[model samples]
Every structure is written in structure tokens, then in C-alpha cells.
Target: MSTQLSEDEIIQKISGNDLTIGSCASQALTYIGNKCGYDVRDFRGADSRWLFGQYTTSQKIAEAGGFVECDYNGFKIADRLLRNVEEGKEYFYTSGEHAAIIRKTGKKFEYLETQSKHIDENGFHPLTVNVLKKRFRTTKTRKLEGEKFLQKEVLIETSKISDSPNFKELLGYLNTDPKNQKREVPK
Candidate 1:
């Protein structure tokens, strides 16, 4: 199998994709789901928590099958997932304001700002939690942790978000047709 991207490389890969607002949810689902090997299927029906893309954001959504969740702002997710992150694992952090994927690298934690516009590079930023006091902050320097409790609301297991589809499946529409049907996606 091919080697995975180093953390630095992953930051570089997603830094300048030009994917901006309203795309965060979709981008999060696809990139994380693909990297973590989630099932990543399309969910369409009543009680469909699928966020964005419908017949709307066709190009992006088709490739990734849309970001599925009830809360786009992530208010519902943040309160539950942001605490108790352990080492060697990846987590998806969310709040009413923003969402990003975070992981542990030894004593420090790094995150991917997946939804920023290409020109605004907020990729692979680091965060340090004051676990002793139940608070966290973005570390500016090794010795300096910026602010306190800077509004991260929750964290979710990345692979557990198994419904996001992407990679070769990206940049086009999803192919959810019967196998017997003979046609390529996005024809």
C-alpha cells in the first residue's frame, strides 16, 4: 500500500484548495472519511441529516456524498466531543462557529482547517488543552498557549464519521446506481 502523508504533508495538501464557506461540512466529511477508510455512502431520505449539496452543490457533493449531520453550526456536537482526547488518535472538533479535524502528536495536538479558502491558509494549526483545568488554547509557541478555552465545543472520532465519501470519488457526482446499469458518474 502507498504510504500516507506525513502531518506536515497533509497540511500542505489541503492548504490551498480554495474551498471556502458552506463547504466545511462536506470537506470535513470527505477528507477525514477517505483518509480513515470510512464506509462513506450517500444518505438520502426522510430524516436525512445530510448537510448541503442536495442537487445544489452537485460537483463537490457528488464526489463526497455530502456532509451528513443534523447540526451544521456544530453546536450540538461540540459539547460532547472536544474533551478527553487521547494520544495517537484523530478527532473531529466542532463548535457553533467552526469545525476542524484534530490529532495528537506526542505532547502536542495539531488540527486541519479544512474549509478555509485557498488564499487563507489556516492549515494544520496546533492546539494544547489545559486538561488539568478543563480548558484549551491554540499554542502560538512551544511555551505560549494563546488565550484560554477558545470556544471548541466538541470532538468526534474521525473514522466514526463513516458516511463521508471522496478521493477518486471526489470532484464529481456520486454513483449510487444499480451495478447492472452501465454508466459512469457525472455523465
Candidate 2:
């Protein structure tokens, strides 16, 4: 069963962990992101899996061996975070007012988890959209070339909004055509 923790409790737990500055956190931390109102569903999507393979050869090798099931067992948020590490994208968290600090690298990134500062901004937020664009272009963008591209390519991140968040919004933005994004097919 899922255990719900208060924001303070969550923060305390995070502080207590030995998490590196930019590496993905244990599942406990992802649960905190959910409780704090951030949407991390994208980390759990097909696109993430594909890009991770592109970025982390180890993960690609793992996928070939059927290790991908570790990501599909629910607790998607945490699974996605670890996958992101394998994919070369770093993981981070921040105070709402500060920049996100990489958990493993100790580098501070420019993205924030909240939208409060982005409302007046005209461009896509780097924290949310840039990495996705990089992922799409590097791994999934060739499909625009022709049907042949689609046939050989790994599936993209496309999923519908069900009763829960599952990375659809992030993928919709990253995909070339927003309307083309599809609900995640059950594995």
C-alpha cells in the first residue's frame, strides 16, 4: 500500500538520505515530489525509456536482457528517475524559490519545479521541455522522415490522462505534434 507523508516529513526524509547531489533519489523522494505538487510522470514514459537507452549504453544492454520490467512495476516516478540517470539526464530537486540542485553531480541547474516564475515567460521551460526536446530529437525525431523511420524506431512517449499523471503532458510538449501523442500502451 502507498504511504502518504506530510511535506515536512518528506523533506526530513530527503535530508536524512545519503542521496548524491544530482543522482536520482530512492523511491521515497519521488513520493515526496508527488506530495509537493510537482508532476514527474514523464520519467515513467516510453520516451524516457527510449532516450535513456540512447544515452546510457548500459541501460540499452539491460533492455536487451529484459531488465525494463523494473520500470513498469508501478512507483513510476522512482523508476523513471533511475532510468534518467542511465539515460544521461541528471536528477535534481530545489526549494521552490531556488534553482534545482543536481542530486548526484552537485551542479545547480536552471530549472525550477514550480510554474510561478514561468507564467510570464514566452518560451518552453528548460527544466521541463528542453531535456524532452533533446530526447525526442536524438532518439525519436527521425520518424518525420518517413514511415520507414517509424517502423524501426522505438515507441515515443505518448500516453493519455487517466485518473493519474503518467508523463503524457511532458511528452505531448516534446512530441512534434501534440495531438499525435498517444496513451501509454500497456506493456
Candidate 3:
């Protein structure tokens, strides 16, 4: 049976553990996935490419259909964590070269990460978080060389709708194509 662990419980379980190191992000993701009734082996298998070659943690998660990428201002990381995240969904946060997981529980957030020396008891915070979701395919059109026609590349891009207050505004602006912009007069 799967047991959903509280933030404190997760922290306690990982604190001072030697497994806390470079694989911390993967470990946290595995814990969350297992609790959510996903097969831990599937997650590990998707994350295993690191042993044979180089692939980003986010890339692995995307391949596993575990999370979707969304946009948020890095400056509002703390506010977004408290206001936007939902319970039972796993969030992946990355800053520069480091990555971690942030899980929401009962109106609060719990951060988890692994790194060399020890597990971060102080909690891990990253600039961005990707929430778990089902995967979907997206198509992008590109110009083909030596031909007047354009070609479409069907890519399995990770995508999500943002929950931020400004999300709608951003979406509206993004939906307006460049041709539409030129047709509209400035106020």
C-alpha cells in the first residue's frame, strides 16, 4: 500500500542520510511518485539515462510523463510556492545547475533535495517548479531549406497552464500574433 508522507516525515526520513547528494532530485521525485501510486521502477528507468549518457533531470521527468513545464517569475518564487501549488502533485524546481522538489501539503509547502555531504534539512528552494501531469504532443513549423514549403516537427514538448495571477494577462499577450499586432493601433 502507498502512504502519503508529510513534509516533516519526509525530512526526518532523509535527514543525515548518505543518499542525499547529487541524486537528491531524483530521490525526492521517486518518493513522491511512489506515494502517488506510480511505479518507482518506471521513474528510475526514465531517470537512468544519466548512467549511459547525459540528460537533464527535467528532460528525464518529461520523458516519464511525470510533469509539465510552466512559467513563473523567479523573483516571486516564495509567493508562487505558497499561493499556486496544489497538494499531491510533485513540483520540480531548478536554479542554475541545481534542482529540487517542492511538495504542497495542507496549505503549506515542503522542500526536498539531495546533495553531497548530507540531505538538506533546511529545505530546498529553486527558481522554478514543474508540476506533475500527463504528457501531450505539440507541433512546431519550421522553414525548409531549398523549398518554399514549411515543415512541421511534432515534438513532445512539456507544457502547462500557469496558476499565477498574471497568467491570464500573459496568455492574452502571447495569443496575439505579430500580424495582429501590426493591424492594431497603439492607444
Question: Which is the leading candidate under TM-score?
Answer: 1
Q: List, residue by residue over 1-187, the lDDT tens digit for candidate 3.
A: 3466765554444333332124433444434443443333111122232431223435544343333333232223334334545666656544323345665676655555432233433344432234211111111221348443321111111122133343233222221222222111111
Q: What would the per-residue lDDT of candidate 1 be over residues 1-187, giving only the tens digit for each residue?
A: 2346554444443333321223344445545544643333222211222333332333233233223233322333332344456687676554333345677777776766643334344455665333212222222212226433323244556554444544334422322223322222220
Task: Give me the runs in candidate 2 sitting further than 4 Å from their true place.
Answer: 17-21, 24-187
Clashing pairs in 3: 21-115, 21-116, 24-114
Better by TM-score, candidate 2 or 1: 1
TM-score between candidate 2 and the true structure:
0.20
> How many backbone clashes can be found in candidate 3?
3
The local lDDT score (0 to 100) that residue 12 gets in candidate 1 is: 41
- lDDT string for model 2 (1-187, tens) is 1356664443332222111222121222233344444432222223433442232422332232212322221223223433433222323321111212222223322332221122233112344334433322223223344532321111111111111253334223222222232322121
On TM-score, who's better, 1 or 3?
1
TM-score for all models, in order of appearance: 0.44, 0.20, 0.37
TM-score of 1: 0.44
Give candidate 1's error at residue 174 in angstroms: 7.7
lDDT preference between candidates 1 and 2, better one: 1
Alpha-carbon deviation at 117 in model 1, angstroms: 4.8
Give the worst 10-residue stretch by lDDT in candidate 3. 131-140
